[model samples]
Target: MTPPAPNIDPLTTPLERERVLAAYQRACAALEAAQQPNGAWAGEVVWNPMLICQYVICSHIVGREIPEPRKQRIRLSLELQRKRDGGWGMHPDVPPAPGDHDHHPNHDRDPAGLAGAHDSWMFHTVLGYVALRLLGADPNEPLLQDVRAWIHAHGGPYGVPTWGRAWLALLGLYPWSELQPLLPELWLLGDDSPMHPRRLYCHMRLIYLGLSYLYGARTQADASPLVEAIRGELYPEGWDVSRFRATRDQIASTDLYEPIGQSLEWLFAGARALSRAIPAVVRRRALARAWEHIEFEFASTNWVCLSPVNGMLFCLAMWSRDRRDPRLAQALQGLEYWMWEDDSEGLRICGARSDIWDTSFALQALCEGPQIDEAARAVDRASAWLPRAQLRADILGGREHYRESARGGWGFANEHHPWPVSDCTAEALEALLHAEHRGWDHAAARLDLSDKLAAVEFVLLRQNDDGGFGSYEPRRGSMLLARFNPAEMYGNCMLEYSYTECTASCVRGLAVALEALGANMPSELRARVQAGVDAGVQFLLGSQASNGAWPGFWGVNYTYGTFFSVAGLLAAGLDGEHVAVRRAVRHLISAQRDDGGWGERYEGVLESRERPLDADQPSRIVQTAWALLTLQQAAPERGREAIERGLRFLLDQQQPDGTWPHDAAVGVFFNTAVLDYRLYKLVFPTWALSRWLSR
Candidate 1:
């Protein structure tokens, strides 16, 4: 007879078990209460102040004055985000000190001169300064003076990045000719062409669509006294159009994340030459083509377009073509969907919404714990809502528009946000499967056999030739496209490449669906699901770093990636003793803190694949939960002590309201900006503790 397996559930003491049970109950109550009446859970996605700045700039250019009350709130937001040195950084990591602008080391000197001085990138600083002025802050005020000094020290607005240049140019503060050409004719390229815009990543292409349209139309605001005054303030030395033209390619060291390569420069020069050579009629036709694509996207996404970045650009493009167009007003109104307001933080435009992502994770967390009656009712509602959220039909002319099949997939934000992502669909499917496993007959009825089959088909279609999955679409362009990436503040953004997080999510979802569907699954669909899982597993196994971590594309560093990787492997029938699983568990155990939790700095996303350990950072509640979940799934026996201690850390940190502290940035985008998803604090911790109780 085989030896009996050791007891993996490590809750030995009655006191410890009692504490965990009580914590679970409180957490369940808190999460259930936080759910929306529509049965979805969405938290504010806090990003940098650049979004607010863009809102201000867009309103000013479009000739719509922000209401006085709204401007006061926007002013408060700017003041709260200001650094001690009177500059704004990408995120609010460094607290501002009162009246300490002069003493801050980077106040007088060029902030770029100091190592790790990312607290004030020129991109945010210039935009923040201008946004404050637009909101009626006095230019001669002491705080504004300090901001001006900082800007002058950083080589003035001339050194800001391409996106900054575009915004300034729209307001007539910068010359359009000086900016790099975003040729609308690129839309005319055939789908077979490697350089086609369709070959670019979804977000990149959409943003470029709006940008090129505006650039083609030469959309600029009519000059006013405010524009002239702001221009003088921006260039204290003097405002010379020729001198500004010379600094077209210049970027401040503080704002440079991915330096513009020689290849990209050549591409820009060629684009300028093409712009000059193209026949007037052909150029007109290309602009028309671009507008058609833009209008399609605007309608498909329920007028929200993709994100605030493109949404504003699309509005400007529409306004430039026909100011009285009804669609323009609707587009502007739709933008309010991305706005988050608070009496304290004022109004902020988030990068994107997270309703589907948050709801899927929250449902999974609820399913892992003991089923209280209230929790069960919440699960039923969420499960019902999720199936309804799935896209039931592909968009018309999806192939013509360079879109993948979204028929059975879920998007990151909601059903109205119709850009389906691989991981979002997978996580949503897994959440429904978990509900089905819990014997929720109502959920099963809502998500019938055909619906599940369509979802599996959607996931199966997202797998790349390399066996991994990209976010929105399959990899469409070469990795060499990185050499031509024009976005100065981001990296690896040119094409949709495969990511570990997306692959792992697909694998786990397919495997769980396969097991749950049992013999009810059709033979053909079952084989395709198995093939996708096997391919996805191979991709995961080969992608592990030498240090046993996987790099995350959408979240912070190794901790987030490793959790999904380990969980996916286990769901695919890999045992804890497998070399890959064992190495991953060892890595997590080694990285645990003295406080018995885990923390990963956002900078790890910028480091080499073998991210160095940052031992000095304080443990974060969300990352700690990720490590605990990974260990529980992959190494219960080996990670028992670490799990218990981590549990204690979480329990001690829980507030009287039953939620964990959201003190650190958890989500990341483009490997440069960090995001604070407020709901992450509730979902991941609740899941970890509940998993422990069930075991």
Candidate 2:
């Protein structure tokens, strides 16, 4: 017989009850100490190895020596992340523990099978090999040989995705013909055209604008011996430049997350053929237009360029244009903003800063606790930072870069990141409102009523016709646009689509805004807000799965989506007795573990299902907290037992310093890649425990 399961219930005898209170106090103190003087709670944005590799490549392009310490750190990061066969996983270390591999179709027991199960891609492997080589690892190093063998087994250099092919060409390791045509002329299309860059997601459009310039000019770095060495090692059978033209559309199965459709291929083929006949004057004008847009993006975002993917591509475009421009120096300097260094992993690039995102959640968590007054100092400090983080009207208006107005919204990271996201804006508004209602006395520099209304207006502008919200803009195009997705490293990244998470956040935030506005809100504005809330609720209700769960696009699986769904509806004035709320509560109850917590695997989100859990894959503190929060909002009376169990789980997991260890990734993008936002564990769990105790 198996040994009895571990007890997860809180040790709540009269003698042990004090420990919970002490733990809560410790957590509050830790957050207070961690707050930045600027009122932000910026945390590490842990991502894959590509950003580090991009950094090394950027340093090489700019002819700057990476500091000895940074170089060593890069080497160590690659060393720690490299799999047994010398390739890196898509995200880091994604295999299940021994005996925990479940019945997924992708499960494999061999080492290579384990790597594939974790979703290793040739796109990432090429970058890893390039990074190692740039860091001065010998070509004949055993690790390099192993990496080469893996690449060869997968399909060699030609099998790389579009981005990889472009990077290789930039390094002078591959020919330009290896990449499909990225037409800068597409910029000439009218705004009304469905193919306009404005309609694409911010990341896709930004990267495309810059990459098209590089491809159009056929820009490449000066050939060096190292480049020759890369070319030799990548193609052991000896490569011919002529071979690339024939295999432009060829991508390896390992690298292809979403294959370009034959129709898209035909369209691209036609564009390439038409480009040959275009007059030189038209080509020159198109390149100029592309350059102008690229420069505008840099100026707007302070050279950060949205994310590292586009940031580095913009840098490459600048380098290709005028290597000696003073602006290049500033762009290089700004790259440090995304660099994260730790004792174990050295340095890697974060997907984004996500300061506002983490801080908003942390504030909500603090306010939910019974002892708001006890945590007053921490609350005040963080609250003071929120109003300052909102975007001003002076930023880019929609007409110029095909951007939506950012006047009153908030972004994921800091003010320097110009794009305002729907969920982030909603969360920020909610946090600010919470601070005000709780009487945190934010009189020093709080946003006035006008500013608050402007934020509400921003949210209103982003609501889709269907009542949901997209990340950056309202849905300008259809999900079918993904059929032309060129980036095989990710999926569903081609267009902006509404998310259940963003929709929920917006509805809840508007409710708070309306409450704060009260009679002061204009009659028309209030009517608009009420309509949006109703439509949004309907969207959430309609989108709920047959299993009573909502799927999260930005976080792991149903847990993330359901939490926002239940809480948002309740915030919009739906009661616990509502059918949608009742079903959601049941789903949470069923998902609760024997240990009284909740755990969700990243694979579950990738596949949009409840993935089988590995025996060793224990419940996560973050998911447990989310479930607790959801239940409290949806049905407090019925969820009391589960909430207590979740609170106990948090108490048990709290570190001595009042932090939670970085568990598995809680953030996702493109429904495939798992990313870590370090503050999720600390902020969400602490928030849940505080609320549970207060209730």
Clashes of each: 0, 0
TM-score (all chains, Cα) for each model: 0.95, 0.93
Each prediction's Cα lDDT score?
Answer: 0.83, 0.79
Using TM-score, give the best candidate's number.
1
Clashing pairs in 1: none
Off by over 4 Å in 2: 1-17, 95-119, 372-374, 396-398
- For candidate 1, lDDT tens digit of each residue in 1-695? 01112232544877888898789788888988989888888888878889889989988887788999899778767776677566988754555435533443222322111224447778999998888888888999988899999999888999988888888889887888878999998899888888889989999999999889888888998888888899999987787988877888888898788988787888899888888888989878988999898888888888987898999999898888888887766888888989988776778889989999999999988887777776788888888788888998999877788889988899999877988988999999888888777765253447878888888889888889999988898888888886887889888789888799999999999998898887988999899889999999999999999999888888877999999999899889899999999999999999888988888767778764544335554588898999999998888778999998999989998988889865677788788877888899998999898888877
State the weakest 10-residue window (summed lDDT) of model 2. Answer: 1-10
Q: Candidate 1's error at 529, in angstroms? A: 1.3
Give per-residue CA lDDT, model 2, range 1-695, as digits (tens): 01111132353464344566678778887887778788788888766787788788767866778888888889777666664445776765354222222432122332111333535578778888987887788989777887888898887888788888888888887887657888888899897888887788888888898789999878888778887788888888887877777767888886666777898899878887887887989888888999999888788888887888787888888888888888888888778888888766678888788889988888877766654444788778888888888887846544677888888899998877777888899998888777676676368867888888889999999989889888888878766677888887688788877789999999999988887778989999999999999999999999999889898888877899998988889889999999998999999998888777887777776566786345455687788888988897677779777877877778888899988775577788897777777788788877776765554
